[model samples]
Target: MGLLDSWTAGSHTADGLTYPTYRKGSGPGVIVIHEIPGITPGVIGFAEQVVARGFTVVLPSLFGRPEGPASAGEALRSIARICVSQEFSLFALGRTTGCAPWLRSLARRLHDELGGPGVGALGMCFTGGFALAMLADAPIAAPVLAQPASPAPLGRARAADLGLGPADLASVKAKVAAGCQVLGLRYDRDPAVGTRFDTLRRELGDGFVAVEFPGRKHSTLTEHPQPEGVERVLAFLEEKLTTKPET
Candidate 1:
């Protein structure tokens, strides 16, 4: 059976873009954007954990085959497709991915239906910075970046880019100033993450809670699977989305 066999499958369309989504559980909503090579077993396993933690989780298949295995071959093929896709801003510095609007729309829809403080949005690996971008427009009270690798991190400039444009960055700053906390998890030596964490620290200051593990591992909540990182994410989501804010 497929890894997603038990989850309810659906599709979301926004800004003239459509993508399939797998959903499960019941409670406050949390959007789990899959890593490269799609929703592999590892990704599914993590999502299941979130669901078990009492979240209505939605897994968006941004790229790669859903339920596909996480092999190097699959990763390469997905990377090739992502590089050519107009939806992602892979090499562009200081620009949000074209798919951000669609994701924002999905978050809004989930929040509107659930009617909580707001929904949680967690993006992993290549899509990691997306959760931050969504905060510019969506009611994403909880934004988690798990090993965000974008803009390719090729040069010094790209390495420090937050994968957000000027306007989006300004909006995110405003949100942070208003008390929205962003949770970021990564290995201390993960080259794929580049210096985006440093950028986030500079930009968000104490608002960005960074949880760094010690190692060269990537994919904090997935393939590499750091238990502490996963628990930190769940706690952050619960605090931001379900807990009432002080008046």
Candidate 2:
């Protein structure tokens, strides 16, 4: 059986789109969107940690083989496919992916079923900024963007867009004003993640929590797995999802 087979497997239908999903654990809800190469071992490992931390983690397999091993060949194939897929805006600046609405619906359903303060979402690699995009819905209390490398990261415009259109960007900003904090992670020298960090800082101000690492490693939770990053993410999730006595 695939590693995903060990998790509860199902399908979610949202905004007339259906996708395979995996879930494990119990508590508040957290949607963990995988990178371009799908639900690879490394991504699964990260999700397992989230589950162990007491959140019901939901992973939607957007591309690549579900629960596949992380390999250069597979990564290249997934990248090529994503480059041509209309569901994603490979080189478009300031436009959300076609998949965003569907993801937003999924987040709403997860929050409706497993409520706490709200839901947490972590999007990595090509889908990184998706956590931000999902903020169009109000239930996303904590959004984590890890190495959000989309639009091929080619030019300044693409680097600054954060894969969001103007209206969605407005919604995200409004959410920040409502006390929904966003967490971002990237390497100091990863060309895949251009100046979007600066954009986020400027756009969200104190609402943006940025964790920058030295060198060129990408994929904070998977591929390059940083222990500190993992801990920071978990702490952020706990802070947002846990219920505290009213002071």
Predicted candidate 1 versus true structure: per-residue lDDT over 1-247, tens digit per residue: 8878899999999999999999999999999999888999999999999999999999999889988899999999898998888998679987888999999999999989998999999999888999988999999999999999997889899988999999999999999999999999999999988998999999999999999999998989989999999999999988887866689
Error of 2 at 52 (Å): 0.4
TM-score of each: 0.97, 0.96
Instruction: Identify the candidate with maximal TM-score.
Output: 1
Off by over 4 Å in 2: none
Give lDDT per model, in order: 0.92, 0.89
Candidate 1: give the clashing pairs: none
lDDT of 2 at 240: 94
Native-to-model Cα distance after best TM-score fit, residue 176 in candidate 2, in Å: 0.4
Winning model by lDDT: 1
Clashing pairs in model 2, backbone N/Cα/C closer than 3 A: none
Each model's RMSD to truth, in Å?
1.5, 1.3
User: In candidate 1, how many Å is residue 197 off?
Assistant: 1.1
